[model samples]
Target chain A: MAHSEDVDHTSHGQSMGLLRVLGPAHVWALGVGIVLVGEYMGWNFAVGKGGAYAALIACWFAGVLYSCVAMIDSEVTSTVAAAGGQYTQAKHIIGPLMAFNVGLYLVFAYTMLEAGNAITLGFLVDTVAGMTGHEGGLDQRPFIVLAIMFLAWLNYRGVLATLTFNLVITAIAFSAIIVMFLATSPLLGAGEMLHKDLMSGQASLPYGWLGILAAMHFGLWYYLGIEGTTQAAEEVRSPARSLPFGTLAGIMTLLIAATLTWYVCSGLLPWEYLGDGVNGAVAPLFSAAQISGSNALVWLLGIGTLFATLASANGCINDASRAWFSMGRDHYLPAWFGAVHPVYRTPYRAIIFLVPIALIFALGAPLDQVITFSILSGLLGYTFMPINMIMFRKKWPLDTIKRGYEHPLHPLPAISLMALCSVTYFAVFLGYGTQLIAMIGFYIVVSLWFHFWRYRFVKRADQFTMPWPRPRGY
Target chain B: MMDTWNYIEYGAWALSALFGLLIVIDWIKIDTTYSEEALTSSREGELEAMTEKHRLEG
Candidate 1:
């Protein structure tokens, strides 16, 4: 069946806002912030004593899993290349109702992620204040709300501004990380770095190999928003060319930088000293701070962690807001979300809609549940996505588009990637019951509601109606 | 680059404002008119088709 015929290039500005500040390195740095910082924090929080060695390896493996996911998203983005990102791509492959449900689910997942990251920022600030023996107590809720507004305003400016903020914050965050590594280099030894005691059940996984994949849920969860960069492909300079390269470069740099930090931190800090209690989340970072014995490193790492996590939320807010704006323009969402800021050329109305929802999650929902749901939803999204790419290769049959810039081994590598993601998804579900239930329940409820609202209610012809009067200008 | 001010912290706030400005400028400055080449090609095709129509009618 035919979808909507006219593809209006009605975006904020035809010229990509990416050029205002970001270069390649800055973009790569932002990518690191988006993909790794949250993952690192999750590792430290959940894994406790074994975080450095066990958690580190698991996440590195997850990084490869994430890279494969990225590849699939890129292929789909290239073929359809809609401003709506995954939602629009899914609409073209499946149907309008299914796409609408998928879009709603994504919005929920991303909003949860924004809250989770903002909460992490609050945790960092509060943790550091406590460590310094500050008499005044800090609460995470107020700070989380404030952080959400700050990121929204930053994104409302435009793509360049968001990327620039990402770059600057990521640079400072990376600098602090590098300083910690350099400061602790002399004390690193083989025994401390490779220390793993299987009998203690501290650093080693109980389920052997499968436990590593299950633990990867936390590590890979941090790298969730890297695809948002590709989502902004139309707003980026040279979508067909630059966006793919940028995606690859960003993932690689982030993986290397984060892996190095984890390896170094694991070596310098002793396991017992690294963890305060079982499943203590803040231990690995605290371990580093203790080894440094400098209040400067402690505060710097704490602040850097705060900024890094906030940046991830900021990236998602910007990306998901744009996706909503695109949906509004295509009549999948209400007309209000389509309204661009006349002055800023940004989707202001969409940003306003997102803020309250994100705040609700920050105040009401649990962070770990949000993190797990985000991971599960991402895996589900990727699973549906590569099928679109495979469809395009067979149906559209463009040789260059099909074969170009994949993992050298072609469909086989992609298939392997899919296999890994499936394994990871099942392993994570078996490992954590509540998270699995939350994810499944969220998807099913949303999908069923959307089926009635989108298809049973709205006509197929009305799916692509323009929210605003068609402008005379292109 | 040595001894230069570290703009990392402040840069975050500043670039946000700057990118907003860039979007505004691009929207105002971009030429929205159809290109002459596109118009010319359409006119040529129309003229050729019109002449053929007249010959058929005659």
Candidate 2:
């Protein structure tokens, strides 16, 4: 008799599955962990683009984008119930080529974010070293590599421990925001904030309507990876109920966090200082704490930044590995990557593969540029959402199947997502037009390669993994 | 004469190398132990086969 170590009831050799033990809390943790890091740093870059006022406009506009995405994602993910999230959805809804592109988008988006997170960890350490009397500052290369490896190890062990750790750290990081809000006491309505000065001269409408358009690019930092919750759809115990509940809750939490973050930062610093180039503060929250002259606030926000960074990196490893593993299982990539760890029931190979790739991104790429690449990758994935939702509803009409959650305003969310994505695309184009076109061209070339070469390896009949009936009109 | 921060840097690099080695070792072990067929057979494939059967019967 073959012995088994994981999922006790399943035999050693037959069809082992990922552990299905996650709940709504784990889903929230996964999504929030991947995204909360943005609150600490990147969102302030919107201030760089559009000043304080335009950045606020981008924030709420992005909020609308988040709601639609959450709704559309929850519905499909709950009904489909698989890893690879959008990749799996596209495979079933569209065809293999679209699926291939979506899968690559998911992988790159998270991997880039993971790399950004690791670099931020190194920067945080260097800053701390200087603060603690080490003037020359420690090198960040090893710490960056170490962060990637450590998180990969956590992911390698098992999903349960990894996401549970995410839950604890994500909760603490989020509470730091809450604590900052309370400490700043902006609601006291005294001269605590420069709300009066918000509309002064160029600060409010510096670049005309174009500034608000430009800010939308960095606005994504506020809620970029919340959609990653669905990547863990396969592992959730009750994907139908838990997927929607956890995802909706995650988006709502981020919405509140983003608004408060904008208020706190913009209130404390002048628009110019908050979003400056040569002399700007990199860590906006820490800068705010410094301005406040509160030792307690400084320490809390500092630790919060560290925990949020680690949590984001850890969650990135988890989601990116799942997307890559899902592709491998389907033969879109090498089958060698499809293996799950027999003992840990994790995607060990994919986790290992991403370590060096993310390390290169961390050590080699510039910070703001790497983050923009991440946002663009995410946008590519989101651009597919409207098409995915529309086709999904067409293929499996509401009466045809049991859905965990049906989003109200069926085509409205889908249409809204498309419009917002178009505006954001133009926003990115205003700035990084060359890189944007290059990324799309790269995906197209890869998709062609898959169509001509890799499709033969995938068993056409076997690719339809969901047990649902044949799609309508097929 | 290496300084203190340099040693700390070297130590961190060593720990990272150790982790990488562990991962590579486990990776090679799994590749050698499991058959290509066994490793790639997933829950999704099983479900796909089930659907194929159901479609045939229907």
Candidate 3:
């Protein structure tokens, strides 16, 4: 098998290396950190479709699905222990073409999600000010741009600083959610909130089973970015052990957090009211604080909202840039993106490249559209995981690879996750319509660019070899 | 059908509890240490090898 020795291998004047400073704790923090803000918003929109009850049901299903997927992901990450998460795994299992597609999907997913967070952060700032009797909302464009640039700079600073920042903010975000639940769970009449009447009239399963289906994508918010934790595999200590522990622990934490948030928030306000409003995304937390009349808790929730957004965006910048770095290192992208900073020992160039794209999307796109695009792209990338799992098992065999953890159910988890993801993808396509089509168009353009341009670069550079079978005729 | 608000409530909590149990089991069972062979199999270790080879040749 040929390898990609075409990599420049120099960081200008200084050498390059990704510092291995992460442990299971840092990985867990990252896993939770990337997805924590989902509890803040995005998930609440499901209530509009399925009511609180149906949305809760969807959350439960998505939770189970995510838990299974996380376990399988842990197994793969433990074996490969590579950066770029799914892309790296897929490359070893399926070859470069598919890996390129998956890599692009992941980059799109993370970047779009980061942009979505920036937009949400803008909305959150407006909500915070509005609640404090400040009139009107702030323009979110400049704020989103500034936030993206700031996170880009932080990521350029290096992995330890980035992960440490993520860890501290994630801790604070987790605590705030718990405090919100505890403070409000007592004030609201749980019975009243969950009353059958809440689901009455036209709103009662408005779209029937389809409503539940539509809600699945929203429920995905709770665990959307946890898989990106695997991207940190290259930076972690004893990744074989830490990846599994971190990802599993993170999934479990998210499960409890999602359920508790659903329980507390669903009971605090009428499901209809919680599901309404222009700022519907953050309504649950906002309503919880408002109804409870706890100014301190409200402030805490606000601060938590801010930190959660920053943490998610910051973590995503780390993940997305690494994906770009890996591709660039392998010659799938311009070699410039592969450059590491001498001082920071981070992929400074890739991080810098990501900033402008993220800023453009953050400023130009609407939040709902960005969220849909992000989820769809992520789900498309995720469909490869199960296939990779089955392929990896066949190629490496359990006896050959030094796996840190193995899925007890083997192919079943992979099959189940694939089916669920397919269903969710179909539902998202149906619900989002034009946005999904645009995403498909985006994929086609990327694939074409790779075939006509990047593949030639790889071939010329003598790094085109892959472990898996190449795409036909290529 | 078991699709009521109560059903949703209990079901979510049940799944959460189940996940919590799995986490506890994993915490107890998962090994934190890596064997020397496993360490060598890591991406970082591979990079280190390449760097060393480059240095030796240069």
Best by DockQ: 2
Model 2 misses residue A67 by how many Å? 1.0
**Candidate 3 Cα outliers beyond 4 Å, as residue runs:** A1-15, A186-207, A277-281, A459-474, B1-45, B48-58
Residue A82 error, candidate 3, Å: 2.1
TM-scores of chain A across candidates: 0.82, 0.96, 0.90
User: Tens-digit lDDT track for model 2 on A309-338?
Assistant: 999999999999998999998888998788
What DockQ does predicted model 3 obtain? Answer: 0.02
Candidate 1: TM-score, chain B only: 0.35
In terms of TM-score, the best-performing candidate is: 2
Question: Across residues A186-289, which tens digit of lDDT does each residue of candidate 3 receive?
Answer: 46423334435555676566667878887887889889999989989778978878999999999999998899888777767676677763544355775677
**CAPRI grade, predicted model 1:** incorrect
Candidate rank order under lDDT: 2, 3, 1
Query: iRMS of candidate 2, one decimal?
Result: 4.1
List candidate 2 stretches off by more than 4 Å.
A1-13, A186-191, B1-7, B45-58
Error of 1 at A241 (Å): 2.4
What lDDT does candidate 1 reach at residue A78? 47
Clashes of each: 1, 0, 0
Give fnat (model 3): 0.00
Calculate DockQ per candidate and list them: 0.03, 0.36, 0.02
Give the candidates in order of DockQ, highest first: 2, 1, 3
